[model samples]
Target: MNERLLPVLDLVSSRTADSAWLTFTARLDTAHRADLRTARRLLAEFGAPTTNPHEGHDMPGMVTDEELAALRSASGAAFQRRASQHVRAHLEQAIRIGSAEQRAGVHPATTALATKVVRTGSAELTRLDRLDRTTAVNRDW
Candidate 1:
């Protein structure tokens, strides 16, 4: 999931006209990168298999290749709108997954990371909602 988010973050940062959205994307990028590092460290510490289970699966909140292609062709506000929508979906799905981990995960470190994921993702969702509201109001005026 973090791997998938990196390109979208770069795309949105490059094409978005909204400063707030750009900043949000940057924050997501940083958090996701940290999540990846934590995941790697945990895997090594516990000697768990490092294979990606979701590599080919259609996971929720994962943007499709076609969607990414379209995003690459978009510009300005269009890019921002689509990017925001995709990012919201991604965050929501991540939070759901994290919440599940928190409930059923056996490992202390893993569950702790899940808690952080839920907390951070929820905050990002709130920020995304505010940006949407502001964008809608600006469009109306």
Candidate 2:
């Protein structure tokens, strides 16, 4: 894993809850039939890796290739490329379609969670270089 991804790993780990699971579930609900079945199995195994003693750290925030493949299948090929534009936008697109069909409530919360999931997408690490300066320069720790 890239060092830059650590913050995202930490952020997601710290914040994960029903919303995160909801987003994950939403991804499943929207995924292609072929990909959805496999992704669920893989994620289940990853989430409960019998090899790892520590439960919390066992499954980090990183997305696997399988997950990406599933995401692409769910979002479509064109979306696969367009998703690089912004995580929030891509996820919003997913939620727009998924939630509307699935009838998930609390639109505001779902929208917020979608933003988080998108920000944590793979390139999110690379995006930090250009995206962080503004916040870093303004904030004091």
Candidate 3:
């Protein structure tokens, strides 16, 4: 087991948890509101194992001040668009970090956790895509 991978896993899990928190707190439309709540619950459950005990470590993939401002200020379709983009980016980062952990030959527990994160991320990406398509179709009417 690579000792270095532990921090990576912790960082990825923390960042994912943070993203879920943001999504759950955001004022999303009915289409994604329930999903975000579910996502937050799952993230908190899965990400708990990898939480770093050390303080002051920067959370990777943390939303920038500007992005937070934009999301907070956005409304209607703009908010949906920004949220979608933010979620997609967060999933992508999780997938990448999970892959790295797998490749690093970390402990079986870590590998299993990483695998779960990747699978969850992929599913979320698919759901987001479906939601985007549905929104586009509705807009055509």
TM-score, per-candidate, Cα-based: 0.93, 0.21, 0.57
lDDT of 1: 0.87
Task: Please list the residue runs of candidate 2 whose C-alpha ends up more than 4 Å from where it truly belongs after superposition.
Answer: 1-38, 41-122
lDDT of 3 by residue, 86-118 (tens): 667666776887889778944676677677667
Q: How large is the C-alpha RMSD of every model relative to the true structure?
A: 1.5, 15.6, 10.7
Q: For model 2, how big is the CA root-mean-square deviation?
A: 15.6
Off by over 4 Å in 3: 1-61
Candidate that scores best on lDDT: 1
Error of 1 at 16 (Å): 1.7
Q: Model 1: per-residue lDDT, tens digit, 1-141?
A: 887778888897568667887788888899999999999899999998899878866677988888888999998777878888889989999999999999999999999999999999999999999988887787652
**lDDT at position 101, candidate 1:** 98
Candidate lDDT (C-alpha), each:
0.87, 0.36, 0.53
Name the Cα RMSD for model 1. Answer: 1.5
Candidate 2: tens digits of C-alpha lDDT, residues 67-99 = 444444433223322222333333344434444
Q: How many residue pairs clash in each candidate?
A: 0, 0, 0
Candidate with more favorable, higher lDDT: 2 or 3: 3
